[model samples]
Target: MKEKIESKLREKFPNAILEVNDFRGDLTFLVDKNSIVEICKFLRDDEELSFDLLVDLCGVDRAKRKDRFEVVYHIVSLKNRYRVRLKVRVDEKDCVVDSVTSVYPTANWHERETYDMFGITFRNHPDLRRMYMPEEFEYYPLRKDFPLMGIPGSLQLPKR
Candidate 1:
């Protein structure tokens, strides 16, 4: 199953793939952000490889790395009883990635939550806005560099 999925992706997206990792039977592909939407579409539409379920979508912040962020998609083919982990690295300079909401409608909230937490924007998202933080919040609280004690007066408190 892994071989089939890897071969198809390699053949179809030769230039878009960056790295492939298999740890404890879990397969992860780090791919180019530019091809993320197409790759996901193909993954979902392919008849033989029907990845019909998007189990999870989230973001990672790697502040020390040159590409400071990674958006991860955990998708599974319930028919095939297998899953693939797709990842796209995002640079801090251009922290935008094309949204996968078209391919997976459930991605809407995940993308918004990621944006609110990591400050990584998802282009073409239906409603991209803060999920937990206020709209005026200036800093992403989840980043490794965020102050532990919270930003002083970052948000206004209601009079009790």
Candidate 2:
């Protein structure tokens, strides 16, 4: 299954995929961030692959790496009973990527959550807002640089 998916992706988008890994029977692909939406659409619409389910979408903080942020998408093919993980690495300077809500509507909330927690923006998201944080909150809590004890003065109390 991994081989088939890899072959299909390579055939479709040569030089677009950055890396491929097989760990514990799971296939993970690191793809160009600019082509994420196209890649995801192909995975879902392809006849042989049929990755129709978007199980999860999240972000990772790789502060030490040259590309310090990574957006991960876990997709499953109910028809084929297989799963694959797609990753797009974004540089901290440009922590934004094309939204997959057009390809997978389920990504709406997931993208919001990722944005709320990691400060990774999804361009063209219909209603991009913080899902878990207050509208006034200014910091992304999940980033490596966020203080473990939380930000000071973030919470305000009513004046007496």
Candidate 3:
């Protein structure tokens, strides 16, 4: 099944898929950020693959890598009972990628949370606002460089 999926993905987007990995039966595909939406749509709509459920969406801060951020998506095919993970590498300077809400509406909140925690923006997201942090908060707490104590005066507590 992994081989079939990988072959199909390669056939569909030969240039967009950067790497493929299978570890302990889990399949992971590292793909180009530019075509993430298209690739996801294919995974969901393709009858042979049919990755219908968007299980999770999150971000990883790769501070030292050429691409400083990685947006990860976990998808499952209910019909086939197969799961696959997709990742898109995002450059720190850009820190932006197209929202997958169109492909999977569940990604709306996930994307917002990723944005709030990692400062990675999802372009074209219906509501790309802070999910866990206050609207006025300035720093992304999950980034590697974010100070553990946080920015001075960034948060104001009510006077006791």
For model 2, where is the 10-residue window of minimal lDDT?
148-157
- lDDT, candidate 1, equals 0.94
Instruction: Compose the digit string of candidate 2's lDDT tens values, residues 13-73.
Output: 9988999998998889999999999999999999988999999999999989999999999
Kindly report the root-mean-square deviation of model 3 from the true structure over all alpha carbons: 0.9
TM agreement with the true structure for every prediction: 0.96, 0.96, 0.97
Model 1's TM-score against the true structure? 0.96
lDDT for each candidate structure? 0.94, 0.94, 0.95
Question: What is the TM-score of candidate 2?
Answer: 0.96
Scored by lDDT, the top model is 3
- Name the lDDT value of residue 68 in candidate 2: 94
| Per-candidate clashes, comma-separated | 0, 0, 0
Candidate 1 wrong stretches, greater than 4 Å: none
**lDDT of candidate 3 over 1-160, digit per residue (tens):** 8888989999999999999988998899999999999999999999988999999999999889998999999999998999999999999889899999999999999999999999999999998899998999998999999989999999999999
